[model samples]
Target: MDELFKGIADPLRREVLELLRKAPLNINQINDHFGHISRQAVSKHLQLLEDTGWIRIYQAGRERYGYLSKSAFYAFKDWVDAYLQWGAHSIDNDHGVFLDDTAYKKGMPLTQPVMLQALLSKDKTFDGVFYTAVKTTGIFCKPSCSANPRPDNVIFYDNKDDALKNGYRACKRCKP
Candidate 1:
């Protein structure tokens, strides 16, 4: 997790990931996108990405192409979801803690506690950021759902696809 976080810590690295999303590219093709940076610098970024398992580098004839690894991102998501789950369980969701828009949207939290708080308070700002999965009910809800769930029974997922894959149906109330 630390390696993955460190790998994506730089804006340029993140952009490389974004670029790779469109299509796989060799070092030269990737370096061409950033005119100001040296190819060596780009190589370093590619190396970092490769080292962190974010990308798979392979030789197609003489050219080496880098492709994004979906599993790496899934792992990252799982880690964040776990963090949110821990936060939701560790903190009191009713005190209005981490419920404020600034707290959840600042690119930091603000996930589990904020997610649970959003679920409890029906905060619309976090609707798509994460989904609330109720273990006992076997249903998932958008953060803005009108239904009130016990925080202890909730597991947070960053994507609705995950909730669906996990065999949890979307709630009738939220239609998430």
Candidate 2:
């Protein structure tokens, strides 16, 4: 609770948290959305949020990306559910338990490239990573990218450390 208040105490930090909730972003990307703010300032704000346990940072290639903390959201959900209970609703002849398509789109696989080499390999241990340097996206992969007759897009990585270091993401079709 102390950390949550610290995170929301500053308007700038609150906004940063909101922006990252939609998608992961590096410092530059976050700064680009606002005017009259130095990147250093934004970086400081991010650090505060990270320290407060309100956000998490991950390395994607040479750049660092910011994302909302799962703990924060889960806590918020618990508070909301405790205080207010909304009635069940339905849409399109189905219950409201349906998955939210928009929220689903923000996950990693939707934007990640599909790595083919990893998909073709016979080794089950090599399935999680895929990498390619020459491709337009620089790197690509799928969780189950261990097949054969590798597609033109693939260049597999032995592990996530290598794939991420090379700037690859888990593919959308078969998310890694």
Clashes per model (N, Cα, C within 3 A) = 1, 11
Worst 10-residue stretch by lDDT in candidate 2? 87-96
Off by over 4 Å in 2: 85-176
For each candidate, C-alpha RMSD in Å?
16.1, 20.4
Would you list the C-alpha lDDT of every candidate in the order shown? 0.82, 0.59
Identify the leading candidate in terms of lDDT: 1
Best by TM-score: 1
Model 2: per-residue lDDT, tens digit, 1-176? Answer: 76778787999998998898789888778989877888888889989999988898899889988888999868867766643332111132222222323322322452223233123322233344334332555545543332222255555455667777776654554455
